[model samples]
Target: MTVEVGSPAPDFTLKNQDGQEISLGDFKGQKAVLLVFYPFAFSGICTGELCSVRDDLSSFQNDDVQVLAISCDPVESIRAWARQEGYEFPLLSDFWPHGAVGESYGVFSSDLGFSFRGTFLIDKDGIVQFLERNGPGDARDQQGWRDALQDLAA
Candidate 1:
């Protein structure tokens, strides 16, 4: 089942593009997390979506919220992708156990061996405050996420 609002998000410790351990709990108390699960790095839609975040960073980067983009790609690929795309946020590698974290949140697309467009807004308390899932190739409605974050920050 997909994660829902008010439900506690599953905690995970994934490696960032730099191969450093980064856990969902790492940002506790300081910032809520915007967990973005994409299909892959360097994909057309994925790049566009992430670039949008990079272009308007103030919407995501602040004291109240931290944005993290995750994919099943290896750390090396993620590192290169981040450099090419100029993604300032952490590009986490859900690689090793192969989409295990994505599976935990019910976002794994087993057929494609990747994640669909699943976005979860996890509050400081570790509960999901907003969640959205779109079909393959479907871009997200980012306004919804921004609105939710605005309410949370208020």
Candidate 2:
């Protein structure tokens, strides 16, 4: 039930690791956003996935594109995790509303009480350029994201 490509992305305001509010609309007409919704922080798969992004961020580091990682963890936990993981990108907290943003993207899992692996590439126009979701316990194919970004940057 992820967002369809070419459709308008749903806007939302959520707190980042520093507790500062970040709204999806803030990037409109500025940069394309890579909105990543994961299940938790400090977990093995989650750690590895984010680390990959951290280690090779130049691929998505241009002024025209920004990466935002969102999780159901609280701001405090996300802050600590970001520090520990050396994630220079914004890690948003979807905790207060308990996955409200994830729910809007159709990635929230009520039973697991967290968001699944929903990854979206939103263009500067606030349109969804790419949308895909992996089931719980399934590792995402990072190359797929890179390929999409390549297509967008073309």
Candidate 3:
């Protein structure tokens, strides 16, 4: 089962595209977090989804919110993709354990050996505020996330 709304978010530490380690706990008392898990870096659908986030960064990430994109791809791959896409938000590498974190989120596809599309909005208290998951080959509507944030703000 996936992490659900009102449930505590599972804390994790993974390297960012820059090779810097980041943890969910780092934002616990500072800002709510938008955790995005995709299958891979540079894949067509993955690129499109993240590019949208790149283009709408202010709405997706700010003083009140933080965006962390996760993938099973290696740090080197994510670094190249992020640099090419001009993504300002952190793209975290769930590569070491080979999708361990994604599995924790219940988004990992064992047959495909990667994570599907999973998005979670966690409040500053570490409780999940929003949760959505899409299967492989499926795309996501980010507006849902925006709407959720708007609700939080209200």
Give the best candidate by TM-score. Answer: 3
Residue-by-residue lDDT tens digits, candidate 3, 32-64: 999999988989999999999998899999899
Q: TM-score for each prediction? A: 0.97, 0.97, 0.97
TM-score of 1: 0.97
lDDT of all predictions, in order shown?
A: 0.90, 0.92, 0.93
Report the error of model 2 at residue 2, Å: 5.3
- Sum up the clashes in candidate 2: 0
TM-score of model 3 (CA atoms): 0.97
Model 2 stretches with alpha carbons more than 4 Å out = none
Candidate 1, residues 1-154: lDDT per residue as tens digits? 6578889999999999888999999988778999999988989999999999999989987878899999999999999999998888999998879999999888897788998889999999899999998876999978998998998888
lDDT of 3: 0.93
Give the C-alpha miss distance for residue 67 in model 1, angstroms.
0.4
lDDT of 1 at 55: 96
